[model samples]
Target: MGHVMQVYLGDKAQLEGVIGSKDEALLSRLLDAAATEDAVDPKIFRAIIDGGPFDEDDADEYTAAMYSICSILGGQSIDSVVFHFRSCPDIADIFYDWAFEDLLPPPEGSGCAIWTKENNAEELAERTADTGTDVNDGGEGDEVDDEIHWMNESLLAGKDLIFFWGV
Candidate 1:
């Protein structure tokens, strides 16, 4: 059988399905190119954006489109893609559920672990503490308030990137 090529936006909803080895190679190459540079080429980006069939009610299609864009822009693949815009605390819990409930299996590894933000934050926080949260906490010689403000601003500016993947 010939190679089958499926294009998905962000969710698994298929945008275009083509049959040909060459087409499959081209698509894979495009994805690789986008993933490498942390940016998608305008031509490829426009192609994906314009190629989908119009379906206003299709949430899956829109989600898939976002994923396609992310994939093109170096986003990794997880079983499900959960988007958290504008930084909410619940975002971490959402990711936790995705990992433990959807992706991770029991100790025997019966199921796959999905990606979520909870796990990421927990890990990040732990690492931050381990690496020394003291840098943010003012020492006796430095101004504590200024240090706190600077840390807060830095964290706010360092927003998490919108994509992740598990191999």
Candidate 2:
């Protein structure tokens, strides 16, 4: 078998298979925090957003909804979704914007990026590697290289790329 890159390209139904349903208790707590005008505790927020239930059909749409809900409950502007979520390092892992820097912009809160041969996926991967932020780097450079190679092969074969993170 060959190395595989962690990318997702599908509607909400497919994402549901990836992340699954939200826990009722977590939702209730988030709602309560909003009702009381209290900041959402980071731990609770992570639990809900990271692996929490997702009943929606479009991952992009659902994630945006989540950001809105979390932001409102936290009394922060929706525009601060990235900053607010990034404060939690684990949540930061959910955004793959770096991978799509010059490619098609991933929808905000959708957590998806597109890549194509025309956009130079190979060059982008190389640039990412050179910058030491290839998204596959969890202290494993060789593995990341292999993933880049896999992406190159896929793109060369005329397969475009759509990646999802943060779920």
Candidate 3:
């Protein structure tokens, strides 16, 4: 596959299986157009009103994250989650453990993808090129990792969560 994205609306039960996806009809419809035009559908307002599958509420922040993800696909930005681990091995370790090794018990209702099972080789290679990292690896990954960590953390903590990912 050239490039693909698989978004999740809930937690990985054991680094593999996930709960059902509730908002694909909403997110997929929005991103399908946003991918090309770098614009967001008005439906985003509704998604914001409904609150996140997680707890992130500010539509502007989520919008920035969403468009930033689009920027990565267009080569205008480095992949956020990918560069996070490449630069800050320590912080990356915390996130990575949650991603794979299960360092923290995943939040109960958090929407997250099981990268090992879901990511194709092309995406994996891109994520862990292991060559070099952005000058501000810690800073760069902070946004992406924070989005993911707390979403999962909320689930583990039994709080509202959201669906978030990028290719």
Please, what are the lDDT tens digits per residue for candidate 1 over residues 35-151? 766644434333334443323344223333334544554433322433333443433343332222211121221112222234334554665566544445435544433223333
lDDT of 1: 0.34
Model 1 regions lying over 4 Å from their true place? 1-48, 51-53, 76-89, 92-160, 163-167
- What's model 1's TM-score? 0.25
Is candidate 1 or 2 superior in TM-score? 2
Q: What is the lDDT of residue 18 in candidate 3?
A: 17
Model 2 TM-score?
0.29
Model 3 residue 141 CA deviation in Å? 25
Best by TM-score: 2
| Model 3 whole-model lDDT (C-alpha atoms) | 0.35
Q: Whole-model Cα lDDT per candidate?
A: 0.34, 0.42, 0.35
Distance from true location, Cα of 139 in model 3, Å: 15
What TM-score do all the candidates reach, one by one? 0.25, 0.29, 0.21
Which parts of model 2 have CA positions greater than 4 angstroms off?
Answer: 1-110, 121-147
